[model samples]
Target chain A: MKATHIQLAHGNGGRLMRELLETLVFPALGCREAFTDASPLASDKRIPLMASDSFTVQPLEFPGGNIGSLAVHGTLNDLAVSGAEPAALTLNLIIEEGFALDTLRRLLESAGAAARAAGVPIIGGDTKVVPRGQGSGLVIASTGLGWRDAGCALDIRSVQPGDAVLVSGPLGDHGASVLMAREAFGLSSGLQSDASCVLELAHAVRDLPGLRFMRDPTRGGLASVLHEILQASGCGCELNEAVIPLRPEVSGVCQLLGFNPLQLACEGRIVAIVAVESANEVLARWQALPEGQSATRIGHLTVDRRVILRTPLGGQRYLDELAEDPLPRIC
Target chain B: MKATHIQLAHGNGGRLMRELLETLVFPALGCREAFTDASPLASDKRIPLMASDSFTVQPLEFPGGNIGSLAVHGTLNDLAVSGAEPAALTLNLIIEEGFALDTLRRLLESAGAAARAAGVPIIGGDTKVVPRGQGSGLVIASTGLGWRDAGCALDIRSVQPGDAVLVSGPLGDHGASVLMAREAFGLSSGLQSDASCVLELAHAVRDLPGLRFMRDPTRGGLASVLHEILQASGCGCELNEAVIPLRPEVSGVCQLLGFNPLQLACEGRIVAIVAVESANEVLARWQALPEGQSATRIGHLTVDRRVILRTPLGGQRYLDELAEDPLPRIC
Candidate 1:
């Protein structure tokens, strides 16, 4: 028989769920704790960081990814930005009745591989089945626990004028791909999800002496992230649109959707701040990776506490926080 | 002005949710780490026994309980059964759109107070707003981490056939109350919910060397607890139905609903096993507490490998594992 696809049955504590975990996910994630109720996390000598997030994207499965990989990536990113080495994660699934088993398996396969790439193990997890109509498709919640290398935390409040802002990859790819699959505004495009792990990028450059701050732009998008940093760091920021990287296709989608590219969500990307002298070193390290070839210097910290955007026509205007929700039900 | 009921605004990050936690819960459970994104737990000589549970009962507030108290009790019991000393807990709320602010505040107050009463603190928590059609009132997920005390464990595998079965307080109260509220199975009795914290009761019997196992009957009711013990210990059970304690009103509700009292749920009660020599002492300790006043000698463990019920008719019948879904969404 061929693969049956993911269903609620695969989540049940039966043969199907067992086989899926053992065959696909276990090898990728080191398979030690994925089946347990929870990963045993103990704080060692270093300060530990833990974060929990829930993914509620619609359609369960989407182009360039499904809910599974996104769940792993979303959580790993949270831990990475906090300057911690993600140790283990707990994946809990709330599956609606009658969900296809084959789809679930494929999602788990991708999720496990993503966790492995991030150098973290998917330890303990739980599965609960809700009756049909009570819940739709599936809702996945992942909680991550990581250890912060002592004295290596980047202070978000310590960012100062003349600090350089950097992006590890192009922006808006994730949101664009999701909208393409969702058929929102009657638009369809062949865009894949950019859901990949970023633990390596975080670890590789984490030890930089001049590093000031870092964050993963998820909900509220890049524009919101910038605004948050300004407000939090008590500093101003200025961006050069020409230098900021964006996929041509993503730009097109944003234009038609009347959405700002910077306000569009990105699943697997990083924004780092560093001293001007170390900016070249950090950029070099990021661009060396396959996922971060487009890493660019997008902006610079300003003494004035305002966010200014350089328009395509070389005009300058303050870019305020987006007043509207860009996307809901996003991981 | 008269007090208003629960409104959707309460679950918002604004005033209602804050007042609920600040006024009701924080005062009782303490203020530290209550508002943080995650509750940080520390340990020394004692190992933490972590457990989590979700409650989705239909009515937000029941006769003798509400979702708040249930979340606290459910989590503490999980730790208790593992023979751990209850320490701290995290409470996560998934509030549906339009949930009343007043109602949520009241519920949190109750939940917070309940945790304090159990000597447990509501540490970390999360809140999400789902669309109206997506949820029923609200769902609460509580994760509790407890410290294990020396000589406080009851390993099921070591249980022997001569061990005796006992129960602290009555069964069927919570289950009967749910039926009365649901108005299902032609039952509309005004039975009260038996939701209560069992931490004290669990601790009282922790030092009993004869303690073999303990469990609280909730979803599948009292019968399922017995089944779990029998399976884990590889022993049979013989239950004396005549001696199994039940409230008169709860028994009436069960009869009207065409359900057996033995198959009903009990949130605050416990099913315990001990060596016969210590059974009387354990029972006496249980009877002294107000919550354990209705405790009884419910059954015994046997090598027969079959669960049997001794009926009031002087006849014997199989006490099969409860297969019928007695009640749904009872945490």
Candidate 2:
């Protein structure tokens, strides 16, 4: 069904967002490859990739990272998960008039530090300002460009029913942290966001022939990413709720707020589908890295065309794609 | 001096904008080439170029184009003026929640038409939405990627004192049209924006040995572009008041508002510095295109370090970089 007016859910990285893009935005552009995280620039040798994203989170600064750092990590992670080494990025900022210059400086510094950490250069950018009260302080949109390695081709079509699903670390910390940071929740802990790029993880598993696909669950969190893979690969997933990694604080927050942790955002996590034979090796390599110490096998692709979750109590429940936004502007 | 807060002028594409970039952004990235319209991507055989621009025009729709077309033209024009052949573009839209779906459809259609006209593809993009009252209806950020031909290396450093200044068409129409559309100045006529991509003009002059530099006068308009060229080339400019083209309606609006037409924005215009020997040929070639029928020679670079305007009354006036925003969110 066509929407007469946009809803907040349209940006929630869920069903409404996908429907909106497929209906109003994607068909107009006539570029089908854009459905993926990044598009491959046509080349004779290496496959060049590019992706763009706009960050709009209330209270620009959040635990573990801010909008600027998120911008860099988000764009670079998109390229990294697409099997590309981020070479350069463009930062486009829309600051509200009367926004503190010091805040801008701090944000840019954070972005620069993140870029340095990731070994990528911010090669070009544009800055614009809206009148005060028209924006939520600042919005940063970053575009990343990179190139994939030779003989490292990965796609959803390569996945099979037996492929193993692995997550690099805990999920939903970013979403939960941002949620707590905004609106007074009064339930605060030492939990922080997981907002970092996983280039190291990509590097560790890039040469593996069994790696079928990789994605960073940001918006609709882990559930959305799994659903997307199912849609693309025409397969299903069977996840073990007992094995899924979730921080205690994050879980507490989700339980209190009545939010499913699987539907929350994770800025610095990687969801990889690998051949069952090489899953152990990939998990071992990931566990060796500091960013992936919590790497574990959470599930495997199934022949049934539905995502099933097996709870710790040995009960099975279907995890459908979310239709409503649990949190707005969480990323 | 450092600004404690971001001023509207800082995003005006004028003096303050340059200061903000040089002081905080450029140094952080450590990529000096980003100071240009597009940065050269590291490649073995050819220099691939990328440019990004964010459109935050008020009213969403204007006389000549909407935010969508402006986003496409603004980005591609940056690449075109940088001596790159238009290749692919990425669209990032941040729409206000509750924005009309039909309006978005219209805007996307406009953008698709513009991309088709330029023979470029919209390859990849991202979409985000802000709550109502937090955005000016819609904002579009577009990133363009292209490549420079082997021999067509153009830069401000190559410009000399004897180079001629040429503009593709009348200036200030876009700024005036948008301004008139925003407020009821009680003075209206058949004025429309000159929003277009100068790819054909760029193509006509790409092979010319004397083409030193090219830029589109968007924010801060024609005068700001001249100031930028002067800053880079360490040269001055002398413009003939009688020869600078301005539409009658635009001139009238400027008169009513006590503004200089040169300080207004032009979405689809080109200010090129070419050697005096090839200036006439370039102008003639531009005149052949429907979009450049008003191509004319307005001035020439001079050894003096100031932009001097020679009036029709035999008096000279200095043109300074705009310090205040005559129109905000003019795109």
Candidate 3:
């Protein structure tokens, strides 16, 4: 992590990435909210959340979704998790010269559909072209804006020792699918990305007084988010490994690759921390929704600042911050 | 323009770029404000503007600004031209693996300075790295949010015949400086980019009843803006080419390179349309500002849908849509 040059791990949304943001980006830019999922805009009444991310998946097209839909879903989820009502998005595209028109058309169509489904519009955008070989075929960057009533934001400060953590659905499906699609390991499990907007899940629990914090396990996956909450709140968690939801196909791919599924990405899932008394209610509401059908309580926050996983074998292990990005550009 | 593949022209912010947005992106995305500089966020009271743009300039650094400052200026100008007071920004970085850390730091510093000067903060960002050679060292895509009192937004539909067109300052400085710095044609110039934020100018005349529209002449330069106002308003223009301000060095390079300075980019300039009665007030107010000291009345909107250039030789000629991209990735 001491490397001077940018390593793939620096963009992995893991430890190195956190180091880069805290050391270089945040300090240099003086951005207080540089590490948060979304930052609240300056407002008197309802403060809107604004956040952005750049998507650069290797193959562009994958089993469950393409880069377009992934871009839309990624930005929307960031806003949703920050307790905002998704409103609008801006699409910025850096296309390689001589790229196929039909491919661009297809991607935009998917992006349009995702926006429409989420009830957001592509408001304004920019397009730039780099010479061939100087750019990936396509790179999409999106910024999402969402508004919510004041005091409804999910801040790490809100998490207390007794808060319970829950997962909306399966983990690692997105990372696994895109990795399998790349055939990097000479194997294909025919998995699909679980990329979708979870505004519905956010809405179900948005008004709940017990909701403390929420986040989407994206690039660095569930482990990264857990570490973020622990570090930010100065608290610990005892995660029940057996209760963590995992799709069999996704777990199979990770096991074969000797990768931890908990450290893999999931595009369409929510990691929620709520009062222990209301955990079951939140789970029930999420489970009633199609995207969150498998919602379950995975763990609970503690007084210390270490993440411990309670294995089904009656043993315990510390879940450290993800070191290297096993799957680069997995969106 | 009819080609099935995206050529460098499509990203030039000229005719081809317009065609792509109109025929493909806009239609597919169903965005009514797809062509505007910024879109108003949905709200019952004050409406804020949201916009995004990607910056991928060659050499990364130039005389007046680097890609980082350019990223900030470009997005802020877009929001300003749309008549909003810039509030926050999201920075998304796509870096090439192994890119120099010092270089990244310097760029971030510049970006930070620009954001601070413009009174906007870099709230959140996502960084991803592509393997070396797949990217141009670094690419920064930024999204900006600006708020305006309800009903203060500028729309192209407000343009009308007899409206005077004004240039904030010299044209083609940015495009010329970057083009010369590339040394692609074995030529170099001491000229610097006019890259800057014109929020002050935007605020000065934003409340003027005569103000119709404003735009930063970036990618396709002065000619492009003229054409855009004409096309969007379904009107014509009589541009006095002899009166348009031009820096001697920029014009020299453009002439030597067999390019039209009129089509060259100007990152810090504004092309505005205002009522003839108030054009003098707008010009005088702008000229009093440092960035707009060279401001001058350049032309007027007409009743027809054709743009005519009043040549210095006293002959009139058609000013067509930017037919080619003289310098790609200039901004």
DockQ of each: 0.19, 0.14, 0.17
Candidate 3 TM-score, C-alpha based = 0.86
What is the overall TM-score of model 1 with all chains considered together? 0.82
Which candidate leads the pack in DockQ? 1
Query: What's the candidate order when arranged by decreasing lDDT?
Result: 2, 3, 1
**Candidate 3 C-alpha error for residue B110, in Å:** 0.8
Give a tens-digit lDDT track for model 1, residues B1-331: 1224333333333334444445544554455633432324444564444566667665667789988889788878867866777767666666666666567777887887888777776655555555566656667766666666645557767788978999998787886786677665564556788888787788788888888878777655666666666656788888887888778888776676677777676788888889999999889988888888888888888998887899899788886544434455554
| Candidate 1 positional error at B323, Å | 3.4
Residue range with the least summed lDDT across 10 consecutive positions in model 1 chain B: B1-10
TM-score of 2: 0.87
Off by over 4 Å in 2: A1-45, B1-44
Candidate 2's docking class is incorrect
Tell me how far the alpha carbon of residue B139 in candidate 3 is from the true structure, in angstroms, after superposition: 1.0
Ranked candidates (DockQ, high to low): 1, 3, 2
- Fnat for each predicted structure, in order: 0.03, 0.28, 0.35
Q: Looking at candidate 3, what is the lDDT of residue A276?
A: 96
Q: Could you tell which candidate, 1 or 3, scores higher by lDDT?
A: 3
